[model samples]
Target: MPRRHDPERRQRIIDAAIRVVARAGIAGLSHRSVAAEADVPLGSTTYHFTTLDDLMVAALRQANEGFARVVAAHPALSDPESDLPGELARVLGAWLGGDRTGVELEYELYLAALRRPALRPVAAEWAEGVGALLAARTDPVTARALVAVLDGICLQVLLTDTPYDEAYAREVLTRLLPAPGTRDGRGPGSLPPPTAG
Candidate 1:
């Protein structure tokens, strides 16, 4: 069979960049290093991605798409009108309340994005998607808060040897957020009234 030009092999490099960033953060990314990890030719790296920005953009795209895929993977995660307190919590728990490699990978991906300007937009897009998901039942301010909380809780779990409790996370965030339709997702309005009582 003839080779497939415009092949997914390029995507493979991008995906590997995400993994490498997940494994080693931004410092670990390089055309040659990623090429080795992907087991493709180093020249293929230059052939597929000529600039660092292109590579970073590709990696960010991979990460953003991957997270969205995970969110879409669950039926409950997409439906904001559901019993959000319970469902949102479950989704948050599933996404971060475990010791899953994805959470760890996300940490690395985010950390790498911090120093890499080219990748910053990639991170922002992913954040916006997650924020939008949370905003479904709450306001934008809270949506941002929710992502922060999830990341914080994940960090806590990462630091500790103790077992994770998805239930607790669900309960806590449920109490913190307002009910669905209480507000129209911080759209065309000022921020949600000061959340802290």
Candidate 2:
């Protein structure tokens, strides 16, 4: 019989690479290590990923995809009246409290982008996704600024053991938003309709 392609094997290798980065940092990633982690022959890794850079790119893309999904599913992203900052704070707190590994992996990918230009697009994609969600409630400038602020807060939380403070986050985000009744020349108790992406 002619040989058949094993599609899952490629994904398994990518998953193993991510796990390796999460546990040991990107420096520990290697075909041998990923193959061993995935319980596949070392050759399988090379067959799927021609080089370490290729593997890392795949891993970074995968991580970004997961992050986008989490953000997309956030209630605040969908609810116009939801407390955006509070939702962000809650998510950040949960991530810090129990999902440290994922946070670490994400940071690792960001660091990797410093040396690999190819990996930079992955970061841009993440930022764009976040910006689109924020744009729904604010102007483009405010949306961009919010993205930057959110990133700074997340980085600070990751670097230090500071517990996420929802009130503080809300205050910061509120500063970025237009006063409750003034945006787009609307009257009191009004909010701008969400911008369509």
Candidate 3:
């Protein structure tokens, strides 16, 4: 009899590990812990990953993939400078927030990296890739600053219980935006069509 490939099962365990980390913190993770979450045999965890190091790396990749998706889905609006408070608010509202998605899981992996040195590179890549993504969206001089604040906002909101006001986020984001009609890395202003009269 042919044995069915449990590649899907292995992925299922990795996803479960991320959620477990999100809920219980990575400190609580173990073969048993993840296996319990996935309702799989302990041997399966060993079968898929020979060492805890392997498992942690796999989990980090999973987290990075998810973060990439969120970033691609919600990019900041172009020309934040020209947009008034209303348009600014709309853009921030649609942006990737701290806790709304699973920022917690990613942060937890960050902590885990302190214990697992191999995971650090993967985690660092996540930060750099996301930073570059935002920076590329804005003027060269301000791009890094813009990315930093947006990332900071997510970190702040995650640590709190209070509601995050979209309007307020925009205000903060507005200050972070480049001056209106300023040129990018490319030369002079590249203006868009005029809005309705």
Candidate 4:
């Protein structure tokens, strides 16, 4: 028998790995399982990914794109005149508003980094990517803080299975943002200073 040309085999395997993780979580992800899910030869998975960690790294990288795509779709996030906190809260709402299966899948692969050393760098990429986008609106410190707060908010919502409150999220995010005219004298995305009541 001759070999068949399947250009999308690698991507198919990655997609299958994501589905497997979504259904059975990281514990259920294996080359055999991915092969069956992808419907490619078992050898194909092994050939593409030498180890489970390799496959996981690919899946995590792909999963991390879910939120990034949402963020990218909102150009206002990069604008200085936009309401940073409100925009971020709105973005979070949009991400969380859709079917949660993708969100769960992304977080599962992200959390797997705790036990899988190979996945740590890939997991960090998600934070780094978001931070870079936020850097345009604020200082590096604030950008990093925003990432942390966003992560915490997402975790809380997912863990508690509570409805996402955009208003609460915007208020919480507002506290982390620098007051107007604070960042390098470039007043972009600055919320008014809080009143002392």
Q: What's the number of clashes in each of the models? A: 0, 0, 0, 1
What is the per-residue lDDT of model 1 for residues 1-197, given as tens digits with 9 covering 90 to 100? 34447468977888888777777767778888899988887898888899967887876676666567667777775565565545655665566654466676766666666677877877888788889887876789888888887777667777785555665665556555755435324222223233221
Query: Which run of 10 residues does model 2 get worst, by summed lDDT?
Result: 188-197
Error of 2 at 70 (Å): 2.5
lDDT value, residue 57 of candidate 1: 81
How accurate locally, in lDDT, is each candidate? 0.69, 0.75, 0.65, 0.85
lDDT of 2 at 45: 91
Model 2 TM-score (2 dp): 0.82
For model 3, the run of ten residues with the poorest summed lDDT: 188-197
The candidate that wins on lDDT is 4
Global local distance difference test of model 4: 0.85
Using all chains and alpha carbons, the TM-scores for the candidates as numbered come to: 0.73, 0.82, 0.68, 0.87
Q: Which model scores highest in TM-score?
A: 4
Off by over 4 Å in 1: 1-6, 22-25, 78-81, 97-99, 160-162, 179-197
Candidates ranked by lDDT: 4, 2, 1, 3
Give the CA lDDT, 0 to 100, for residue 74 in model 3: 41
